[model samples]
Target: MRRDHPMPCPDRHDALAELALGTLAGQERSDVLAHVARCHACALELSELSRITDDLLQLAPAASPPVGFELRVVERVLACSTSAPTGRPRRRKRHRLASWRPAAVAALLAAVVGTGAGLLAASTTAGKAPPAASRPVTLSASLARHGRVFGHVRVSSGRTPWLFVTVDDLTGPGSRTVICEVTLVDGTTAKLGRFRLSQGYGSWGVPLAAPADSLRRALLVGTDGSVLASARI
Candidate 1:
């Protein structure tokens, strides 16, 4: 049915599938989101694809392959090679299906550990600085939708107050780099820094000027000027 909407491109379909399967990376995922947000047809397609994926996940894998199925497959291949006029064709499967399971597992583990580490790091800093004594500051923030976290904010025990930012969850690898600015309550904005976040959570420390009164309402702003979060300490 030719509605008023434009059909999504084939590439978008493939991108959507890869993203749904947690395979797309780098520019690919970005391209998918950009397209999906603008195209109603693609958005609908993505919805259906997500539902199909959920259904597939609910379905259990066959307990076992049919008896002798592997043998039969090997035999068929041998028969084809033997029946060929020329010697067994040397053509190789040009592309292979990559398994992201191992990498994903590693990432999941890192996220678990990172979350704990982040909490630990935040805790260790507690009471260490006088400014932090008033209220505990939390460094929690959301990665802008379609955005990536790259670097760590530097926080060291010294006269300066520092806040560290970490990338806990992201859509792609650690390649995505984002520039962020930190704002103090006094209306002073500092371009803290830029960093790349690969797969799991990443940490960075940002040095702050003295006079911790402004730390209460401190905020982390992304490149797009979105307030990721406020410091709890």
Candidate 2:
């Protein structure tokens, strides 16, 4: 067989037996060689036949066959020749066996690709920043300390806004406390209803009706009447 072309074995059994006996011609011999290379059972049978042939050749003249030996050999050869027509079943089985490999490979590839895509999506979503801590209080004193009228509102946006505040190191557990107040620039102040802070920051949201635009001038104050930060919306 050529490197690229598969060898044809129309009568696989006879080809295998001839290949074992080393009696096949050029193309037929190549075909049987290809088949045996890929088939362990055929290879073992070929090895056994070769050993038997070698042993027969080593027999002495006194051990030669009787007068009817040639006739018996011819009969056996005819019998094997008659059985050659049954090769179709073996060919069909081989074809069916070969068809499953590509299907299995395709299924494995699809699973790998699907798993990779899922992981990629998960990683992307996990990499994003979380929502800002609820309603944040902006203090006027902190904005004066920083020499800036504008500050950040660390609060999240929603139907009900929560208060979030950050305080400096004072006579408290940390720079954070649960007591704070939110005063808008419009002179309307909403007392800190309920709040909690960790590190230097805390949050709480009061159920008060205010215009969306007025939120920009909001200021957050600590419990000791000190401004923490201020924000415009």
Candidate 3:
């Protein structure tokens, strides 16, 4: 039998967040990986946070000014100077300066508009949900064989549901293709996907159509039709 680890401690959760953000490295990274392997709640949290991180990256990529923007500003300033009035030297100088003034003002306004637009977009996205609701509910279960724990199954719930499986400490083969199947409440089994394990260690995740709570159990099967491990949800 395997002991159930409690939900993430503050330090653990902070580590998980850093891991998801791709900022954790060195000994700290290795420690978090080892801990997540055995901690169900922390693993689920990491998975959810990872998905949120991915979405954020996709939604807000790096921003830059439009192409040739600087060149266009220079052209406008040059055009204003070239078209300056030439009747009187002093008056021409004043007119040239006045012409440059409009160009500078236009350039400033363009910059202000670009910055305001970016701010508005960020605010709109942030307004969609409260900070507390950013992390969705994720569920987990232990996979075992003959009363000995071997792996874990995690399900994330939100607009996009996901099924994540991790296997460690399995014996018998160096490499094998494992099939992930889920049993619904009505006794129906659905094969989510398959992944290869290297020396009894690997992790895989796939988007799921059914909600997380609808699953009754998760199973890991070998290509040879042998039941490797099973987890009750």
Candidate 4:
């Protein structure tokens, strides 16, 4: 008979969602990753959610919000703020009240609205800004060497560009450190970061300092300083 695995922990739902959204960071992210590494259920959920997120990013033709939408949202928030209870505050509620900053409230409202529309809008100021409705431009190239493709690299454009890499069928030991480097338009090479490949397969992502368009190419380098594969961005 086959054995059943335990389901993901209830308390980890929020953390997993944040991780899937690429918002989890610092020690919290490390902690969640550690747990997911050991918990098969959580890892499976993360993978499913991540796939869904990738699908969502590929949605076509952006949508624009109606005029006065921001104004109306701001008015509604102010209306509630002015009408909120002014009576003697409860001792137990002080902490909650203190945590409710205007920016946080606005962010929450934006998130709620974005969730209903299926795409999270980037942060905007008072003026009317274009909605990030369509998917960001993503440039991709295959990582190849000796006429054989071994991996792929992609650059997604935004205020802060991101680089994604995936490697497979690498002829190497089970696990080893691999370096990711980018060649700038000016001919200077910068080391983006490093990641460990497990059993010749792994994927990693990192934010890039240079604009995606400014990168000429990407390289995957082995520990012995050999160029394993290169991709033209």
Candidate 5:
């Protein structure tokens, strides 16, 4: 009866996530831990995944379900189910879900497009920089006179050059949009990227147009081209 005891199966990688969530019980939990002990890669992956699970739990607090939430869910489920006419089971998405699919897809597409467009910069002097697939160089930025924005930049020598930059800040508005411009050693500026801030003030990464080590400093510019924030690297 104990799911924490080792199961007969030796390979149950699919259950690792559940194990990390503390939801795998009895033999299932025992098997996963046993496997993790012998497999370094799986153990490492389980540790990494647990961090994300912890982060998400912090972001989304536990709350009571909405009124009639269970009833609505049941109605939706029942409306989509039908008796198997020939004793064959059928699993298909119902038409009721169609109304929201297009809108959701469109919203996702628009965000991606907007993010890409905002990161585009003028032609680079570093010979298109790099594709940002390699190890990164650390950089820093400041918000004019506000505070510091620590960053990391990664650029690889590829045809389409770009910088993958991650920023850090402890104090700022949680939700806002701003442009990043990196001033290069040659006194020319590169479009580092634009970012829409969210609940987290730091640890935001975006693509830019310059190489990792080429910038003298980075500026977070406002709509009117005023430097509101900054980082130096």
Candidate 6:
């Protein structure tokens, strides 16, 4: 008789959010799904993430954009990049797993991930997830007294807008009011969006009204006029 070996796996835990939001595909998706079927821990996690994603769906707006609205932002980013100083962006850690799901899911993923139930099951496989486009630009920042964050940029990151930013690894008070901003290469800032990080994980995926390529920095400013984290774009 031949011995049976388990199927190959990868970083399935990191992709639960993507899987719940229907973004993961190919072997990566299948592996996570399969693992969830056999692993009790993963199944519960999948259920929680799925429930969170469904809740955010209610807050999403259904509408179209005005004529030429995107054009203006694109033009601005282009204009600034031409006059901006050149510097290498910080090195980004590449992952074969999905970057993030949708914007709403990203926000929810950030908050709940701090809970004991939101932590993903551990796995050590080298398989890669489906590639969306060219690798996104990633940036990082830290709060003045406490907290740290990283942002991922993708134009096709989600359905709401042309600019998609995935903010992750936020640490600090859960109920802080903060404004996220993106600084253009030309030294002007554009508002990315606002996230009121609740008690839990502080990861958020927000839509910015600007171009990712022209962004030079990302700032998380508190309501009290303190910088939570400053990230290089």
**Candidate number of the best TM-score:** 4
Candidate 5 Cα errors over 4 Å, as ranges: 1-121, 126-174, 199-203
Write model 1 residue lDDT over 135-209, tens digit each, in one string: 323233333333454322323222333444544554355445544454444444555455444454344443444
Residues 1-233, candidate 2, lDDT per residue (tens digit)? 23233433445767766766778889878877887898766676677667887787778577654222332233233334444444432211111111222222222223222221232223232333332344433222232236643222333233322322223332245544433344444445554332334443332223223322233344555566676555544
Whole-model lDDT, model 2: 0.41
What's the lDDT for residue 79 in model 1?
A: 37
- Model 6 clash pairs? 110-201, 110-203, 114-201, 143-228
Over the stretch 47-163, how does candidate 3's per-residue lDDT look in tens digits? 878999988978876776533334334534454456644432221111222233333333333333223123223323222332122344666778899989787776665544556
* Model 3 vs. true fold: TM: 0.42
Model 6 Cα lDDT, one tens digit per residue, 49-91: 7999999998999886532224323333333444343653222
Give the higher-TM-score candidate: 1 or 5.
5
Q: What is the clash tally of candidate 5? A: 19
Global lDDT for candidate 3? 0.63
Q: What's the distance in Å from true for residue 57, model 1?
A: 46
lDDT per residue as tens, model 5, 180-218: 666767777656446554432322233344455555666
Give lDDT per model, in order: 0.46, 0.41, 0.63, 0.63, 0.49, 0.48
Ranking by TM-score: 4, 3, 5, 6, 1, 2
For model 4, residues 1-233, the per-residue Cα lDDT tens digits are 33255567888999998999999999999999999999999998898789988898889678766422443344335435545556543321112222223343334333332121111111111243332334556677888898898877766655445566667776666778888877766666767667777677666555544456667888999888899899988
Candidate 3, which ten residues in sequence have the lowest lDDT sum?
88-97
How many clashes does the backbone of model 1 have? 24
